[model samples]
Target chain A: MSGRLFHYNTLGTLMKGGFDGAFTFEEVLKNGGIGIGTVDHLDGELVILDHHGYRFDVTGQIHEVHLEDTTPYAAVIDFIPENKTTLNEKINKEILEEKMLGQFSSKNVFQAVKLHGRFSKIKCRSVQKQEKPYPDLVDVARDQAEFTAEDVTGTLVGIYTPALFGTISASGFHLHFISDDHHFGGHVLAFEINEPLITWQTIDTVEQKFPVGDPTFMKTDFDYSSVLEDIAEAE
Target chain B: MSGRLFHYNTLGTLMKGGFDGAFTFEEVLKNGGIGIGTVDHLDGELVILDHHGYRFDVTGQIHEVHLEDTTPYAAVIDFIPENKTTLNEKINKEILEEKMLGQFSSKNVFQAVKLHGRFSKIKCRSVQKQEKPYPDLVDVARDQAEFTAEDVTGTLVGIYTPALFGTISASGFHLHFISDDHHFGGHVLAFEINEPLITWQTIDTVEQKFPVGDPTFMKTDFDYSSVLEDIAEAE
Candidate 1:
């Protein structure tokens, strides 16, 4: 089966102010897809699937975003899983990347990556929204709150883009987490898994959807050099 | 009002056997959008507006694709005209681009471009379906059928993307022409407008939907560099 990855905005433009989103949260979910993104203006981390959107703020407080709410950046795909491979050996994050990328012939297209089962350990972060006269993405990232969870049973939802994607899409493995119990999760910073169930589908196509609310997006002289550097450092 | 420029597939990918499409013709028209694409496997050209899809083939024969038909690549956006201006002076293609781009605050985002009225001259092209052993896009383009219409009353449906988009999108300007009588149209190759009615809207968001076919897409070594080159050269 083929897949399409729907991205709300490019990471580069969002650095300037794409955070002021154009569509409502409900409108985005009507497609009934799965993926990850941040709330408008970087207020929190978001995880969506099956028409429900969960937001975990910098304080780690889990809140369900209403349909009327908007997001600065978001992504989704009508996921129909075609694989269920259970790894037999323990794996670290780096090795996991190697094993997965090795399966694909190329690294340029989008990949729908999902992992189920318990994690030995995981580290994640979430950012708080900035006030008017918003700061650069790097600055916002500098103050992002970090959290850690151990021996948690949950699922990981994310997308993998080619490194060349750079600012348009977040490069490398970008993921968000939500526990099975629906108690803990956020943007993934680090993780360790032992023989977890892995399911991935390479997306044949993608749509880069931009936000409509940011008026200053076009006028700003965003130095992408620094913006990209910050994104890489954070990753 | 806000607009979105929906694209079917990346220009680069379409060059490498992306002809196998996923969504049905009616599904792509549900958004009440206007744009263009090709039938699955490059069978015919497509133009959609007002919940209707118009198909034109290499023979310049116009037909309507059934709802069950699929498109390898297609794009559309809810057309809510935010600007309408009548150009009373004789104009060429270059000056039209100048006038349209000049009205927008920035050329970094997608713009839904539509020109209505009688065209002094217009040239277009369309390709036929390939056999089992599908060749490269540039090869298909080599044998594309070309058509030109003079003094036709119709509308031009298209979009202008940022140059940085390169292969991810066809940068500069991309358009398709369909006569008012629905008897003439194809992928726009060249055109000259004299005192036509022009309308444009800055798309606030976009969603790229992929067709649910082609199993070997992820495993194929698509030469994006060449594919991109072909798109750029053709554009």
Candidate 2:
């Protein structure tokens, strides 16, 4: 049987400014080989590739994530790709998304995708660590640091969620990038791919684990109606 | 560790008239001891208590569900109750719901509930088997057989889903009843409890398994935006 996509907490909790980390990196890696998320206090961008976790800080510095580091939200899978294809032609994000959509047998299921190759240009963003009494995600996003890297070879780990689950997780594609040199990386805002090898797995099963014992998670009344709008603004 | 709530398919798929059964009841029971669902061809109301599956057909006949019986949608759990209480006073469905809500530590997580005791009255409905070209659930529900039993003892099996996951499962409470004598049962529409024992579990983890290999499930494009409205109209 294929391994399920393991999800920690939820975007809904994060949107409500519940950014404290509850699950450790070591525990997250035990569930999957690759994933993307943010560290404690909404610190920077997290990318897990080849079973190694890396953090891309707001100051454009990359650091190897410690096993004890914690995350507020993450979606990871064992990543046994059912389909593998090479895209020799140059393509932008829109074209790549269209191709991926074409490959899906069902548009309503979760999908895990990985792309490894050269990229002519990749624009990314990372958030600075926040202090107590955290503001909502939309507010924190306003001060996000944006950067661009040109002519970088890297791997992009992406998770696609159907529209039905938009509130629980980010709707559509959420991708993070990390260069082979372990220097350039962040949440992918836009990218131009060049001859990348793409591997994707159609995820039919998902294990969503919530921070039940966390006081913040247990006390707050999450307003899901505004979640999609908040995620749109924050992302 | 608490067992995760196991869910099969989505309410969105059923709303779109995809009624073919995919997972076997035997497979569903392996993941949980108690649950609620419908049998193949949208046959009738299905209830599983004490690891035994039973069907309340439209003709007011209850039958033992065989191992080979299939299901298109189901939500089941190993049912380890975290809290147990008894309501000795008479209470209607609305009041019972309010009390259950009071027991919830968080309004955003899934919950499993079981009620066993005497009841003054119970109003319920069961759908007849459908043909190949299955009509949408709303239409099917319109022609459902409604029945009521007064002064009886039975069990009410229920599952509570948060608003965030409304499209995946029923938003609020979805309950089914089965008399202790096995002579009466159906999807509960209204009920009056008399001194019942209530046991509920706060669900922090969920395992959602989709029918990836089913042709109908793979071909249908689920419209989740109107699922809430459809579910409201249907049930």
Using TM-score as the measure, which candidate wins? 2
Question: Candidate 1 versus the native: TM-score?
Answer: 0.75
**Per-model DockQ against the true two-chain complex:** 0.27, 0.66
TM-score of chain A of 1: 0.92
C-alpha DockQ for predicted model 2: 0.66
lDDT of 2 by residue, B7-54 (tens): 988777787777889999889888767888888888999898988888
- Locate the minimum summed-lDDT window of 10 residues in model 1 chain B: B209-218
- Candidate 2's C-alpha runs over 4 A off are none
Tell me the lDDT of candidate 2.
0.86
TM-score of every model? 0.75, 0.97
The number of residue pairs in model 2 that clash at the backbone is 0
- The 10 consecutive residues of candidate 2 chain B with the worst lDDT sum are B218-227
Which candidate should be chosen as best, given lDDT against the real structure?
Answer: 2
As a whole number from 0 to 100, the lDDT of residue A47 in candidate 2 is: 92
Interface C-alpha RMSD per candidate, 1 decimal? 3.7, 2.0
Clashes of each: 5, 0
